[model samples]
Target: MIKAVFFDFYYTLCVWGQSLEPRLRKITERYGFEVDPERYVKARENLYAEASGSDPTTHSLLGTMQEIIGSYCEFIKGLGVQEHVEQIAWELLQSEHSLFAASAATLYDDAIPTLEHLRDAGFKLAIVSNWDTPLDPLTERLGIAHYFDIIVASHDERVKSAKPDPHIFNYTLAKVGVSAEAVVHVGDTYEADIVGARNAGIRSIKIDREG
Candidate 1:
């Protein structure tokens, strides 16, 4: 019997509210480069998946500031920016243009209802995500923080590793005081959540928020 539930942050429960596309285009055009918004989003989605797969990483969850910026540089270069990629990427790394911009994402319409139902059903709830940034501010603002018994991120000092690394899930299970057989993790990604949970001896359900 499942006595607990774990959720992924992005897409599963929340989505980004704004796009940096317009700003990216403005910046790119200023530098004599061009970018297509759809392609940009698509490319980034691919990059993030690659990062999760065994670049064995998460959203700078374990990266230093310099390392994260280097990833952005690679993103610009991948966009076919032959020159000034570093400069352009650096400028775009500004908080306003950053992927980690504060309260940049909002919860899904059903997020609260789903969480409340689970809690009412007597399940322990948690959020275990590969996010690099601290989620307190966003969770608080979204008004969903209180619903969770605990929230763990790859960036957290206590986490042994990020998703796809079973240790992260093991750590969470230990903290939640729940057994692997009694917990079910729900997340948007397969490799990060499903694979990790399976490896850790926990069951998981992959969600397709995009679909």
Candidate 2:
């Protein structure tokens, strides 16, 4: 029996890519740069690729965003004030809704019911995610912070690496005083969440929203 249920934030519990449109528009409008949204997305992919191969010695959301924005800034031939461009990029980079309810996530209709069932069944709840910001602020915004006993993010410093790395999961289990043998993880990414958790000795549930 599982004593605790750990969840991944993006695509597992919440809709991943939910912020893309807003971020694209925000950056385009603020910079007066006509960039293809898809290309902008590719730039983000490049940033992730750059970070993924290296150890988590110094990975951060701002660092990734800076890379992408710097590329864009160069491509645009310095149309607007560098500071203004950076400000827009900064706001877009730090996009997690700090005060919104978890309901904003468009959670699968079954998610809440499942969580409620698990809670009623005496399972401790927690979330371990690959994110730049602290989980507490986002959880507080989502109003579901109360449901979790531990919420760990890459920015937490307790764990520097994101999923696909076991650091955050290991930290969470330690924090909850539970053993990997007694806990399970639920997430959307096969490589990051499924394989990562498995390698860490935690059973994992994959949420394939695309299917």
Q: How many residue pairs clash in each candidate?
A: 0, 4
lDDT of 1 by residue, 114-169 (tens): 99999999999999887666776679888999999889877777774888888888
The model with the greatest TM-score is: 1
Highest lDDT: which candidate? 1
lDDT of 2 at 153: 76
* Worst window of 10 by summed lDDT in candidate 1: 54-63
Candidate 2's C-alpha runs over 4 A off are 16-57, 67-106
> What lDDT is reached at residue 161 by model 1?
80
Candidate 2 residue-wise lDDT at 160: 73
Clashing residue pairs in candidate 2, if any? 99-141, 100-141, 101-142, 102-142
lDDT of 1 at 42: 67
Provide the RMSD of all predictions against the true structure, rounded to 1 decimal.
Answer: 4.1, 6.1
**Model 1 vs. true fold: TM:** 0.74
